[model samples]
Structures are given as structure tokens and as C-alpha cells.
Target: MISGLDPSGGAGIQADIQAVTALGCHPMPVLSCLTVQDTRNVYNATATDPEIIRQQLECLAADSPIHAIKTGALGNAAVVDVLVEFLAAHPDIPLIADPVIKAAGGGDLADEALIARMKERLFRHAEIITPNGIELTLLGGDEDETRAAHNLLEAGCQSVLATGGHGEGEEIINTLYSHDQEPLYFYIERIGGEYHGTGCTLAASIAAGRASGLSARASIAQAQNYVLRAIRHALKVGNGQPVPDRGIPWET
Candidate 1:
């Protein structure tokens, strides 16, 4: 997994590790950046040196067999470039990208340049790109959800999971879009209250499932269910938002 480090442990690499482990996969984490944040908001972030990022990825690849790759909160274009190069070298490794534009609490995690770079480079290598309503709009550059998702697909992403967490309704409707296939909708009851790291956990769970050899559709279903359960058992570690209990056993 390539992501930032969140000290609060509600999200980022911390959440990715917990989610992957809970799903019975070993997380090979490569830190792309570091954030100074809490459960409430991200105050600041610093991108890891691009060379260091490359070295870490190289070391991990040489040491273990990477089944899948998941990315979140890449702080800058340089980090995105590194990932693009890595993905180009290993095209067989599936990529699950959570286009984290802002924190769940409230703060910009990625700027316009990085977002552009993701679309122009990083996203084409992705097997699936997961983005919330707001992120979908921003990344796809269209206000209409369907158009936005389609825009991403046209840009070369194999699939797009446009999450409806930021939408208004009794149920959260997450739609999966791919070329020539009927859009699949997963209707989840909207759980009340603010929660952090839900996106990271969901993406990581999907990566774990893919690594375990599940089909993309099956992996998405299992991941959604896992995240729902984790949210139901959220931990109120800070005064701001509850953190999903990603450490909960998978069988539960």
C-alpha cells in the first residue's frame, strides 16, 4: 500500500494496515507522505522525498510478492510520478486507487496539480479507482455524477466506483462503472454520525480481496460489507469523528 501516515490512526497507512491485516493479507506499506492531523482535520502534510519513495517500493517488491496495490493521499505530483513509473514496470499488479482529495473531517490532502497528474498518469494504470461524490466531481471535472464517472472511464481507468457517501438520501448508493457493462449499484443504509478513514478502509479491503483472488465485482461487494460492519462498530477515539473498527475480525 502507498499512502500517507496518519498519527491519529483513524486513516491513511495505519488504517490500510489494519484493514488489510483483518482481511488476512500482509500489508507492504510504502509511505508517500506524512500528515499532521487529528480525528478532526488535517493541519498540514509533507511529501516524502521521491527518491526515498522509489527505494522503498523497490525494496518491498524485491522482498515480497505484491499481489495488489492500493493508494491514498499522495501529497504531490512527484509521488504520483514515482507510482506511475512503478506501475508501468509491473502492469500485472492490480491497483485500487482512492482519490483522496480532502480529509473526511475537513482539509485538502491533494491539490489541483496532483489531481491532474493522477488523471493524466496514475489513473490509467489503476484496475479500479474509488472516489466519493465530491472527489468524483473534482477528478472527473463534471458536476453530473454519471458524466463524471464516464469521464474517468474514458480517460482509461478500467473501472470506477463512485461512492454516494457525500450524497443525500436514506441509503448510500455506490455505483460501479466499467466499459460496456451495466452499472452495478450497491445500496447501503446510511449510518448516522461522522466517521473517518471509511474510504481508506474500503479501498484497502478491496485490495486484500483482489490479492486473495476474488473477482473485481466480488471484491467490491465484500469490501463494502466489511466497511459497513467496521462503521457500525466505530471507535470514538477523538472528539471529532469516529474511526472505523477495521481491526474487527473478518468472520464477524
Candidate 2:
């Protein structure tokens, strides 16, 4: 896992570790940045030195067998460049990237330059890039979700999973777009109330599923189910949004 550190433990590396572990995978967390935030909002963030991030990746790569890589809230373009380099060297490792631009409770996590770098470099190396409707539009540079997904596919991402949590409706329709197959949709009932760490948990769960040898479609389906359950058992740790109960018991 490559992401920022959220002291509140609702999202970022903390959520990633919990989600990955709950899915029966070991999380190799690498911090790309640090944030001062609570369940309500992100007040500020400081990017980790690019060289430090590179060194951590090298050490982890050298010591462990990395099955899959997942990333969230990379603070800047320099961090993205570091990841791009690492991914390029290990072309076979599957990557699941959550293009987190804004916090769930409303705060900017990534700026335009970082988003541009992700689209131009980091995304192409990912096996699947997960984005909410708004993120899809921003990353793909198109107002239309379908068109935006295609734009990403054209830019070399193997697959694009546009999450529907931010969209209007009773059902959350997460759509998966691939170069060789028709778009696949997973319809999940919309759970009421706002929750933090959902995007982080979902991306990590997908990475864990892939690492466990599930097919991309199967991985995505299982991840969605996991997130649903987690949300259903959300933890009200603070006065703001509830933190996802990522450690909740899995249903069959």
C-alpha cells in the first residue's frame, strides 16, 4: 500500500492496512505523505520526500514478495513519478490506484498537477484505476462518465472502475470498463449516511483479492461486497463522518 498517513485512522494507510488484512493479505504500507485531519476534513498535508519514498519502496521490494500494489492520496507529482519508476521496474505486479482527489467529508487531497501526473504516468501502469464519478471526470477530462472512462482506457489503463457512490440514485452502480470487454456494472444498495475511508478500503480490498489470485471481475465484485459490509457496520469514532468498520466479520 502506498498512501498518506491519516492520524484519525479513518482512511489512508490505516484503512488500507485494515482492509487488506481483513481480506487475508499482508499489507506492505509505504507512506507517500502525512495529513493532519479528522473524520470531518483534511486541514493540511505534507508530502514525504520523493527520495525517501523511493528508498522505502526499494527496501520493501528487496525484502518481500509484493503480490499487488495499491495507492491513495499521493500528495504531489514527485511522489507519482517515484511510483511510476517503481512500477516500471516491476511490470508484472498488479496495481490498484484509487484516484482520491477530495476527502469524503470535503477537503482537497490532490491538486491539478498531481492529477495530471497520475493521468499521464501513474495510471497507465495500474492494472485497474478506481475513481468516483467526479474523480473520473477530472482524471479523464470529460464531463461524461462513459466518455471519461474511455479516455482513460485510451490512455493505456487496462481497466477503469468508476465508482457510483457519489452519483444520484438508490443503487450504487459501480461500472468497470476494459479494453477487450463490455463495461460491467455492479449494483449495490446505497447505504445511508456519509462514511470516511470507503475509497481507500475498496482499493485495498481489490488489491488483496487480486493478490489472492481472483480474476479482475471477481476481485471487483468481492471488494464491493466487502465495502458494503464495512459501511453497514461503520464506526462512529468522531463527531464527523463514520469510519468504515473494515475489521467487521465477512459474510460467507
Candidate 3:
């Protein structure tokens, strides 16, 4: 299941649905917010009522066994509280959190209080938290990638996938860090030009792979490969950044 909805079809649950379906799993999207935006920029995001969000989650949980959950761009503290309560009830399920703090066009997605609450409440329940370099720095209050990721780990996150896409470099370095294990790195040549929804796509793909019974490491590898391919076939649907082509065929 997903936590947010994006009308743009560039990120959030729209990207989650496409990525999950393309990876061969059914997507159960629970709307947390209604965003007013396009591929260009975000004007505003109105979070759904906490009771309605709670009802949506309860209905889905009662009807079917949720194998995994991928959450993106939670809009407020109320939604965070609702999600925390639900996560507490279902502790065994695998959760992949893509901490969507801001939009690609530089609009705030979540307020400071909501972010703090998420780090405190949601990070512990998540199996893995995927944060791009920028988000990691913001989450950890540290500029260094390794130190920032360590901060999150100390705060109770089991594993951290710190994506280097937002950093300035010739190569994109994605590092997976877990307790007592050396960080595993996946390197890919940096693709030129900006692309939308890469983070959401990657996180949801990982969730799909994990739900289908792949190990955490295996799912990370598969998700990175899938995102790279999607970027390679990215679509320039709007005037701004190109959105990833999530439906592109993957070579088996």
C-alpha cells in the first residue's frame, strides 16, 4: 500500500502504482493527500482527514493480507499519527519509506513537525528507509552522507539506502547500510538531465520485489536496475523535468 496521491502521475502513489504493477504486484493506494501540481511545480497539497485515512487503511487491512507497504510524501502530522497507529498494529509487515520532504521543483512537501514525527515514530517500524542525499542530510541534521545515515540508524531505522542522485558527481552512488554490516554500494553512471519520480519508482519497486519474496539486498539491487532502465527511457511529458518511464520493458 502507498500513503500519498499525486495528480501529476510523476511521483507519490501514481508512480508507486505504476512501479508496483510493472514489477508484477497489485498496488493498494491509500490516499493521504491531494496534491495540486503538475510535472513542473507544486502549488499546494491538502492532506486528507485523519479519520478517512484511518478508514481506508483499516478497510484494506481487514480484506487482504498486505505483503509490504511503500509510503511517500505524507502531508501532515495527523496523517503521520494515523499511519503510526496502523503500523504499530501491523508490525510484521515490511515497510519501505521514501521520505518525500520536498518536490523536485523546490516546494515543501512536509512540514518540520511532520518530518520530526516521522523520524521518531515511523522510522523504527520501517524495514528500510530510502532517502536521497538531500533528504538524508535534512533527516540527520548532518551534511556528510555516512554520518547522516548513521544518525538515522541510531534513531532506530533498521537499514538505510542513501541515494547519491542529488549529489554533484560523475557517478551516482547508492549505499545500503545496516547494523553490523558493511555498507553495500551500487554505482551507476549519472544520467544527464533531471528526471521526475525516480525515488518513488525505486522505493515502490523494492517493496514489490520484497513482497514477492526477494531478500532486502536482492530487492535493492533489482530496484536500482529497474530505476536505471526507467531513467534511460524517461519521458519529457511536461515543460520541466522528464518523468521516468516506469512501464518500460525490463530485460530478464
lDDT of 3 by residue, 36-105 (tens): 8788777899888989889989999999989999999888988888998999999889999999898888
- For residue 137, give model 2's deviation from the true position in Å: 0.9
lDDT of each: 0.92, 0.92, 0.88
Candidate number with greatest TM-score:
1
lDDT of 1 by residue, 27-127 (tens): 98989889999999999999999999999998888988999999999989999999999999999999999999898767989988998999999999999
Off by over 4 Å in 3: none
Which of candidates 1 and 3 is the stronger one according to TM-score?
1
Residue-level lDDT for 74 in candidate 1: 95
Off by over 4 Å in 2: none
Q: What would the TM-scores of all predictions be?
A: 0.97, 0.97, 0.96
